[model samples]
Target chain A: MATDSKQFDFGFRNGRLRVAWYALLAVLLLVGGYAMWLRLQGGMRSTNLTSITPWGAWVAFYIYFVGLSAGAFLVSTLANVFGIERLHRVDRDALFAAIVSMVVALLFVWTDLGRMDRMWHPFAWRQVTSALSWEVHAYVAYIFVLMTELYFSMRYDLARVAERGTGLRARLAGLLTLGRRQLTDESREADRTWLKRAGIVGIPLAIFMVHGGTGVLFAVSKARPYWNSGLFPVIFIISAVLSGTALVMLLYVLRTRLFDGERVDRDILDRLATLLAAFVVVDVALTAIEALIAIVSLHPHEVETWRLILFGEMSWSFWWFMVGMGWVFPLVLVSKREWRRTPWLMAVAGLSVVIGIIAVRFNIVVPPQIRPVMEGLPHGSYFPSAVEWATSVGMMAVGLLLYTIGAELLPLTPLDGGDH
Target chain B: MSSNDAMPGVPDTPDRAQLDAMVDAEQADPRAELEDVDFSTELGVAMAEDAKAVSRGEITSEEYWQRYDDLAAEEFGEVYHETPNPAVDHDTAQTIEDDVAESLSCTVGSMASIAESLEEPAGDSEGASEDGEDDDHRWGMVIDLQKCVGCDSCSVACKAENRTPPGVSYNVVMEEEHGEFPNVQRTNVPRPCMQCENPPCVQVCPVSATYKMDNGVVNVDYDRCIGCRYCMIACPYGARYFDFGENYDDEVEGAGEITSPEYGVDRGEREPKKSPVGNVRKCHFCHHRLNRGEEPACVETCVGDARNMGDLDDPDSEVAEMAASTRAMQLKEGEGTDPNVYYLE
Candidate 1:
């Protein structure tokens, strides 16, 4: 038993290492914030954005985090709403990750808006026709739902922390509880009842309204024939699920390792890897259908966009990042029975999937803009400037920092009871 | 009570007393008063009563008027004698003449009236006479591609005339080569804004920045353009270009010295990021030259007699006849854009 505990404690030292990582992230975020300040001082001219290519890195990153947020949230909802008990261990962490990812997504989009001062117009006017206008409303609603769901899931634990009444954690827990305490069996039962109901409702809202709606945003733009597909939204939702599962698996392994806690359920991680692999297959299939329809139509604009994505300037991203790193590497890692048990190997696979999805988002945004609307008009050539890259890196660091802090402060992991 | 007060159009008299006695007898017998009374006075009173009846919704106006006419015929031997006075007709004629005289003093009002009058007459007498002449002649163009060398002189002349900033081309020549390589023959198509007969750009403009003129030229109101660049996308010819805050200061010695009052608006000097600088601009068919009673710079400088300018309604005019030519066709005929600028092969 002692040897087993010692094995579990491998490379796990609490507080010190956690504090160091947090400090590093904090520094990176500050640097990014400074870069963002520089960007605001100097207008779009400071960036390499031109009339030909109006959107660039900020837009790419905006969609990337949106995908990640949607993906992570959906995975957590699967365990909570659908009674997927195997995923329960990582579900709360997924929820926290989602909230952080969404915050980062909003920051990227906020920076991209032409007149950031008039950011209130979308909410104020509420243009029913614009997909972007609808997305703003959905994002707000989704964030509220996430927070509520997180609160319910953490309610019993928060009450425990409030009862203990020791450090900052207890104070925060008390504040979170809003002076309400429910430590009895009946009250816990009531809390569980509310959480179950909220989770059940949240499942469809997350899938159809939030993530699927985002897919509809791109799919509905008839100007872009490549994006105009009925299957695109389905693909988006599946990819969300895939990315969400992968994120949860990685976070679970990494967080457990950092906290000097018991080993994460290897069986659950392996199962998540399998689920992710399945989703990747579906995603690849849908993508194939999308490309095939475009090719068969033989429309000049569609053909040109396809050529640019497949064989032209952006092919490296498609072939190397999306197919190679995103699909093949993860598939190979998850498929091997021996490798499936290894936590670090699975983490590497999950990390690759996350990076690959970012490439996918970049490919989605930049390729379509490269081709001009008119035939004779000049085609756009775009490479994100240093400032754009720096701002993106900074925003990502901020997201990571938020997630880390939340994980450290809160009892994001499940308590040592209520197991069936 | 008093018989003298009862008579029609009489203050107090014996006739009133007599009429009153007759009215009393008519009240008793009804037919007695009808027979005794003079029909002319009765008829006039009846006509007045009929008008009142119509006003009261008792009888239709047509029936009332008809009955009045019959009564007048019986009383005066002809219905024409009681016809409404011809003075109303005379007054109406005089008012119409006054209105015409008043309106003719203003240029737009006069032009509107003249246009309304000329619609039918112009169609009838296409080549009859050119009586109405003004210093401000409406200029238009017809490019016959058969004679065009595709030398791009017209494009050069236009660039020179306008001194357009970079990325803003007022005119362009599109070349199409037909058949596969070995058997291929080239066709040169010089395109300016169709100045479309029914310009889609003018229709979709939210600000009314672009509009069709009476002289068949589709013109842009530069000052009104919000620089939204919607019109640039709407044009089928890709004729419209956005002025992306560029300047001709580097390319030409004094290009920015004086701005062309192209739309007849005297914008003083071309400045960076100014109204027209950011707005969408296209060929106005040279409105400035048209105001000066000269052809467009492109037409005037064409080496070949390839360009023709005339009223399309006049069949005798070169444009009207050429527009009907077997060799002529508008670009993108399938689109139903109805381009005013026709090409002759």
Candidate 2:
């Protein structure tokens, strides 16, 4: 890879691009916020959420962002705890993205809650039986752990900036360090120790409590025979890993490009792509098994739900978007050893997986709802209203804005060290 | 206070010497209290005394009665007739009359009133009693598949009676045309929310929002539902529907003006923000009409009289007898929903 001198002009970084991106994000946020306000005012009437199809785009986005958050955190943990040195360059950015993605996921869920005003009720009056209630607690705990982990990971960089004390970055860095700026060996060791512990604890929590628990939420619903299966949670865990690895790979490439910095480690990106491919393979296998069981049982409700997923009006989303684009294409792109070696090709594969995961979340939520439970009952048909689409875009923009702001203000990338 | 007062059967004005003699005799023998001048007169006195003792709790009333009964037996030599107490007999008759009057008033005011009165005097005869029994009919429903012309009038009537919204239909006729060409036969199965005895909707509802009632109707508690839509997915019969806050305002002049008083709860005027909007709703067997002593809207408005409503528990009732017929069947019986609504082919 050629060292491009033009890419290292950090001082003369364009104010124009920054302003444009920020303005676009701000506009999306405003529009989405306004739609949310409308949704609150009108209740569920503003959207096309019918008795037949209760969940919609908001729920799909909720799980999508959750998968991204969980995925990013897992990747960061791989570098920090497992000592995957090649990934160390993008580790800080991965952690920051994980935190931001989680925040975004929380925001999506906040919007999805029927009684957003009583959102605090889950925290206050915890229902032990509700999977959603447990998820609320797990998410809160995970966010806290993420923030602590990020703080520790950035401690040495923060102290260095504070020692310089020449600009706004120094002042912010000084405050972030909480007035402790020794940057001693002992302090470094302590930071590393805490980061390792947080990562170690967070790994299982992210897999089992946060993401896998989300799968359990739907799986335990015996009412929806389509979602009622033991494999559902396991599939969720696998998909989360898939999405998380893909998200980090995409983020590393995009951030490196945006900053006009040195080339991202292609070997690590390849490894991440391989991991994502493996997860996709597992996810596809689990889905096949689920379908086989459902079909073989000849359970009418389950059969109908499966038919709706495979052959119903919205079956195109399942066939093309989810199975074809999300799984097959990404798998093929990453599986090719030569193509995986190229950073841009790897980025494309990662992007494909990310897009594919979104479709996966959608397919999980919608198909079962469209089929009516009884023969004579009217079948539900749903399409997101303008407000739903706008709000979703706004949510994505907000996530991006958070990530951008964090990246700019914090030491999210490696600084002058190959061995750190 | 003196020794003269202690003398038994002696006058209070007895002389001091005579009282002294009586006291001496009392001290000599405790059994002397029973001793008397004439044996036969004393026996009669003792019998009278025993009777008094019995009344005062000296012996059980049964013993007193038995002693009297024995004396009567001896006197009459098994021919002594003890007539039944007229006061007791009169009290019994009065109590019965009061009970009859109370029952009559209640029956007259309710559906069973005419039946109770018609059967009241016919208690002595089995034939007339059977005739009167038919008056108090327990309401049920039997949907005939053969006669249902697939007009959807039953569904419309149900909507009018139940005030179900656009997406929440209490009754829907599913038309299935089976076979090919010349062998084809069209069957219109009007499905109400099954009102299943073992409803999966009720089973899967986390908060017990939807439940079965004593009158064999499945009802939804709008207030408790969290809009999870789990019941809708669980129901094999596809009987449950979510209230998505839809209205017929664009189509009807005042569709939202009158909301269904489902389960006899009159929630006046359908509105967007009200409950049952974001809740799961299902057929309650036209609970409001049933409460008012009328058949379900579907059964009443079936122009062909194909829908019969009666008590299935009563073996002789039309619904029960029809349900027993070989032609009668229920939808998705293999799923074990045990639907109360029977369809006759």
Candidate 3:
């Protein structure tokens, strides 16, 4: 314990910061809990949502988190399955972020359901034709793949730490290894084999099935021509990669600097930032192409919706956040070799891309919806209510807290010399 | 109808001469007559009888009523007599008779109008309508825009009969006023559920909550709907609405207490956040009213009779005949929805 403490800085932010963080989280939980209760009691009436705009911020956040999860998982695959050894440090952290982001995404979905109790019906009484129903099955398959990959990858380490650890960490590690204290090279190799298999299955599932399926959930709505194009699902995949890259980069910095007091690997961050920069360019091009296609198609609904997205009430989300901060600002920072090499600069670029992705998600959901499905029909206007924002903050806080606690209790960092 | 016609415990009939005198007596600040209950009847009859004599100057009206005054006092010692012999307007009486006849004709008109029917359905007008549907209640609607004054009677009737909560409108009157001011042309497009042959709403529903019936109307299964609002987004005509669990309970007394038996399903007293509350709702072509061998509330209550609803299965029906007109059109015809609701331009 003494040697480990010496190796890793463990200040707990001088204790007061830790107490304040928890106290703030606890207060938010209570506030969000009350808000959720109000929603359950009042149904969607508590929301600013109307018959015109049935989906709102909750749905935007749902797709945002789904993108984040898929992106993170794919990054992890780059290290674990594709043998990108330069990006190996991001592997476990990315996987953990993927799992936590999915949990948060699903929580958003649960909150968004009109009949929360009947949410199970999408599974029990599903229609194969509905992309949403198909998404339900996809989510389950993806979650299983993620869990299996994560557990098998962690097993050898869990087994190693089980013999030397104490408290919940030791108990959790002992339980995870199924009472097997043996960490022979043979078992470690088997663990790697299962992880590789899980990652192989998960790669396709996350890309084409999980997040892409979610994109199809909107694309198949023939009524909304703005989302009906084939490019939508592909765009979802590209943007998801962007978010995932940003999340891993951001999480790595926060984890290493604040908790471990370790100087970030400048080489790794530069490489990850470069990847993020490339993803942002692709994402930007795809968005521009979609906009041009919408203009060229000249479908009234599609054009009108695009008009609203580009210059309507919520256009700031696209211009100020998505373009200004998310794309250009981050791109310039990461594109410059000097800035990319700086850890703080890389962190700023990564966080900007992540936040801009949220704006992308919001623009995707809100603008198209604000345009009426039928002409002469009243257009819907929406702004998130305090309850929605509070609930969102609470759920995010919970996800972060869950990840924090899990990090504390588990050996999230890879053991030296690899699992073998 | 006048308030007098609706008033409780009022005299059904009264003598004209006495009614006039009674009006004059009350108008002139005459002394309050003692209650003559039965004697009043006698005095009224007497006044009617000798009214000519008093008017002819053969006998003074004061002396004639003075003779009846003792009779009025003896009939009821101290009660005030305020009961006027109401003249009962001839027009009002005729109106009452017409009301009864009109309502009775509505009942007889619906069944026979379809059964024996007005026109012989050309038997081969369109095969798309004939899918072995039931002989009754294959509801369809046709709107004659020429006759439609843009009077939103259909919208009002729908609101009243459906008892729809606020923000869930089942019918709408879309107005298109175009051209320069002097030469402007105004058109009213009364929109209801298309009840399409290929409803996009049914196709997009995740739970199969909304479906097109064999009878050609798209109906919602409230119990099955998850209130996902996917159907609303899919609908090209924008006919659908989410319930949002809102209520007119605050606006209209007992509005939340009774839900329309839409699609003939008797969903009892409306409650906040119930099945139908969270479900996506739309016009079922007034399914509840259809099952009762009557037209929808909108069809029944439309003042212009601009919108007609009847069995499309019965080729002779008005709506079916109107639907076959050369001027007939539908909303979003290019979408291939094949909407049953038609409009005459």
Which DockQ-derived CAPRI band holds candidate 1? incorrect
Q: On a 0 to 100 scale, what is the lDDT of residue B36 in model 2?
A: 53
What are the runs in model 2 whose C-alpha is more than 4 Å off? A1-13, A30-46, A110-137, A155-194, A221-226, A291-320, A336-338, A379-382, A414-418, B1-151, B194-228, B262-267, B286-345
Per-residue lDDT of candidate 1, residues A182-206 (tens digit): 8777877776677777777777777
Clashing pairs in 2: A71-A244, A326-A356, A373-B238, A374-B237, A374-B238, B107-B113, B139-B310, B140-B309, B140-B310
lDDT at residue A260 of model 2 (Cα atoms): 43
Looking at model 3, the pairs that clash are none
Docking class of 2: incorrect
What order do you get sorting by DockQ, best first? 3, 2, 1
DockQ of 3: 0.44
TM-score of each: 0.64, 0.70, 0.81
> lDDT, candidate 3, residue A364?
83
Q: Residue-wise lDDT of candidate 2 within A130-236, one digit each (tens)? A: 57667888999999988888888888878876675356666788899877787798998999899999999999899999998888878876656788899988888
Top candidate (DockQ): 3
Determine the C-alpha RMSD for candidate 3 after optimal superposition of all C-alphas.
Answer: 12.8
Q: In Å, what is the interface RMSD of model 1? A: 6.7
